[model samples]
Target: MTRTWTIAGSLSVEPATQRTDLLAEPVAKALAALENHREEAGVAPIDPELADTAAFCEAYGSPLAASANCVVVSGKRAGEVRYAAAMVLATTRADVNNVIKRRLDVRKASFAPMAEAVELTGMEYGGITPVGLPEGWPILVDKAVAEAPELVVGSGIRGSKLLVSGALLASLPGAEVVEDLGKV
Candidate 1:
């Protein structure tokens, strides 16, 4: 299927392969691994100062709905911590207290500490995307995110962003499309 991109604003992007240097190690490797699958990923370098989703969206003119945020949540079971990455539209928040906690079978589910999330994911705090998360971590992709035609996600670093097919994200290994994973 021919892919259509909805990039706006003044951001200039190139094929993901040519921009690996701009991404974190895990993210670069993940991009390489997806090469055989015909993943059409693109990278756009931006000012680190504008790496946050809202800032990036405003600076690049990408619609907020087309921007997806990846958040790391953790819960404890029998003193063991379980981590999961949740992907939701920028316009909504992940249902951590209810849906996620229930799904995880834990009494409580909360966002992981910044240090823990960054260190474990090997990605920057604001750039912790599901693309390169640690093995065995469930990647919960909200239905809306999986259905978007195009999406702008983190590059695993604060210096750039990744533009890819939403379908591609849903197909990532360990990705589970969950309905109502996000809430207004």
Candidate 2:
């Protein structure tokens, strides 16, 4: 079956490989590295003002269920810090306090500061995506997100969004499918 993405909204979808300009540097570099996987991705432009999940969905006509939110979280232990990206559906929240904390094997875990996350990921504050995260950072994907056919996620920039499959996300480097990662 030929795979087609959901872009029924006002956004114009284009092959991510050809629209590298729409992606952040890190995201573009990451996608370029994935020769086979890049073909499975697409990009769409959006107003930066509507980068937020709720606003983007409402303005672009994408449903919350089909959108995935990527959040950066960090934990400290023994003078060391561990950072991970959690990908969950917009309809749910990442179980940061419990599931994520346990998954990272850290005693305490919480959202990473905006400044820190932006500096580290090299992506805009509200446009961080799992595709091009810093090496060594684990990507924890919610089970529901992993099973999704297509999902609207950040393009590492506020001006655009990435269209990708759950399997592609789950196959990203250091990605792990976590059950109950998202709590409704």
Candidate 3:
């Protein structure tokens, strides 16, 4: 089935009904990189409000538990790169030291501040996803989250997102399945 969605306009509109591209701008860049790196995964666009975990649930008529949210982590002591992308379920949080940080080879790691994350991702603070990162950062998904029916991820642009199966997402772009990411 070819999936499609309509964006619920930003917080300032009245009974806002607007639409934009499915794959948000930032997500588009990430897909291009993955494609360039030879990732075979494809991203589907959806209404921008669906970009949020809860909004995604309501718009797609799916449980929020099934949505996949991607967070861009900055200041990862993971190598000298200092930045990374951490993809996990709304039900969980990325483990910093014991797993993620260690894996990234960073001595210290923290979620990038909202402003920094926004500037780097080129998307709003709550709208970052792994689909279109600036490159170099790795995408780590919780193994459990990897099993949901469909997940909502940023579309690279603030105006859209991709709704996909956790399995398909993992298969696409070869997302890594990691254990120990904390369940929240």
Candidate 4:
């Protein structure tokens, strides 16, 4: 029997393992690497044009509070560059300037340029997720997001979204649950 996902959105979800074509290459590889944990994630197709958080939630019947957004940030310290992924709820914004800057221990930190982020992650713009990032990159999951029952997040492609439990997200490689990582 096929399992039904208890996700909040009106999206039609299928096990990500069974719909590899809807996922970006890096996302498929990462999910495959998860092995036993892969079953906990599900994917749903969407109109690529509605990839943005607000538009997606409004059009797909997913509550904004049940969606998570991932952003890539870069900070330069001395001569080396440090990069990290910040995952926060759609209802809140990542504290990039204050929290992430300090966490990266750089003089300053800012969102990575769109071109650079897409190139580095091998994912489309606006569809970047914490999964499949560079092996050593830190993934900061906001406390609120980490506590959610389930969340809709980018699937590395604008054509689909992933439905996953917060615990699953918090357990991804290099994920760290940080308090107050997001701000209203």
Candidate maximizing lDDT: 2
Candidate 3 vs candidate 4, lDDT winner: 4
lDDT ranking, best first: 2, 4, 1, 3
Provide the overall lDDT of each model, using Cα atoms, as 2-decimal numbers: 0.86, 0.92, 0.58, 0.90
lDDT of 2 by residue, 3-93 (tens): 4666437778888988999999999999989855678898999999999999999998988899999999999888799999999999999
Instruction: Provide the lDDT at 70 for model 1.
Output: 96
How large an RMSD does model 3 have? 6.4
lDDT by residue (tens digit), candidate 1, 1-184: 3334766456787787777898899988887877443358878888999999899888888888889999999999999999999999999999999888987888899999999999999999887788878988889999999998788999899998888877878888788999999999
Q: Write the per-residue lDDT of candidate 3 for residues 58-164, one digit (tens) a residue.
A: 65555556556776665543245577677787777778656767766777777778888778767776667666566556677788766765555655555645555
Clashing pairs counted in every model: 0, 0, 15, 0
Name the better of 2 and 4 by lDDT. Answer: 2
What's the C-alpha lDDT at position 120 in model 2?
97
Give stretches of model 2 more than 4 Å off.
1-3
- Report the Cα lDDT for residue 43, model 1: 80
Task: Predict model 3's lDDT versus the native.
Answer: 0.58
RMSD of 2: 1.6
Runs of candidate 1 exceeding 4 Å displacement: 1-4, 35-38
C-alpha lDDT (0 to 100) for residue 109 of candidate 2: 99
TM-score of each: 0.94, 0.96, 0.69, 0.96
